[model samples]
Target: MKKLTIAFLIITLFMPKQSNAQSNGAAGAIAVGAGLLAIGAGIAAMEDMKERAELTATQWVLANHPELNSFSLKTLDFNGKKTKDMSSTSVISFKIQEFSPTDNPTLDGKKQILLAFTSYGWISDQGIDFNKVNWYLIDSTEWLNMMVAYAKVASKEKNETVLKDVLNNGLVVNKGIKAKGKTEIPFFKLEGDMYLVTDYSSEMKLVYNEKTLGIFLKDTGNLVQMARAAVIDTHEFFFLTK
Candidate 1:
């Protein structure tokens, strides 16, 4: 993660020293440096939030499903994703499930199963962005950037229609919609005055026949104990870090 961050800093350093918007070299440097500084600071803050969210997720796993102490985990970066992308999730599966649960319906009706999790945030004319797509594939990042672009147009030209257009765009983009046959998933909401501003973390569960699989322990005795007892003893599941 730090390596990727270093590359961002390097990009800022290599930006052109002169810009037509600046009257002189000193002015240009000052303006550019200030923007870069804000971006870098915001990135650092958001990174910290992401780490905190990950730790909270780990705790949830331990408390609710201790067997998953060995569950494979992965933290992925989704900041650069565009609205057209289809990768809404990442999954982790095991090689075997010899300790299948009775009445389990996965892996030949055995308890062997697959698991997945998700987290997302967005860029608000700043450096940090989180990505998730579940609708017509629009994401917070794309919508925010579009609003800013339209705002710039209205600001520069002072057109009432431009402002109205931007407002309409926001309405269409963010207005909530419902999907059929969707089951409620468990999630953690991370929102505050600091880095995460807006985001959520979740582990996807599969529901069918009044039971959920894929890492969901539906109030059956001590969940952590059940997890610990049935989980795979291999490298396929682990707590991965940046």
Candidate 2:
């Protein structure tokens, strides 16, 4: 009788121990699955945030201005050097002569203006060498056209703050200000020490101070006078200025 009682007690303890082991294993499996799901949710949230940021930036730019159509990015040599060709990431190329309000209007209008720009080359052992020609023509013609259009709108509203912001931000002045008049017209001395007129009409010849920036006006007439200036102080131009 004693032996049977001892055997029964041992059996009861052993059964419960096995059952508890199985329960713990099941709980661990569920916990691991929950952890993986949490990780996946976090990753999705990050991607969503990135997309929202990009969309917000785009909307802000479009809502503020109009009269710009089809911005693009292209690689070109601006410095007249025959270095290795490189790609520009966000070079904003707009259609000046082609842009019309009918086909593409501002965000305020029915149509939403597409604003795009390119980024330049990456930093590496070989530094960034974007062809200067690419920037020159666009800066002179297309970029200027957009600025002129924006200026017209700003001037119509008589918004000096907006007008100044547009000129200072849109117009790429490579040099610091050489001379500024109190009458709201700002003159810049380029990196090459060439003087440029920023607030003139588009029909005037684009002229610069030869001594500093060394920009030579090919044509001297009414049309060229109105051409806007993109004065930059490059690495080479800075040395020349000193």
42-130 per-residue lDDT for model 2 (tens digits): 55664554354345434444554354443321211112211221323322222222223455543231221122222344223453332
What C-alpha lDDT does candidate 1 achieve relative to the native structure? 0.32
Would you list the C-alpha lDDT of every candidate in the order shown? 0.32, 0.33
Kindly list the per-residue Cα lDDT of model 1 for residues 16-126, writing each as its tens digit: 565444456656567667767777786788767556544544454456555542333323322222223233332222222223345643333112222223323322345
For candidate 1, the C-alpha RMSD (Å) to the true structure equals: 20.0
The TM-score obtained by model 1 is: 0.30
Q: Name the runs in model 1 displaced over 4 angstroms.
A: 1-23, 68-83, 86-242
Q: What C-alpha lDDT, on a 0 to 100 scale, does residue 122 get in candidate 2?
A: 26
Any idea what lDDT model 2 has? 0.33
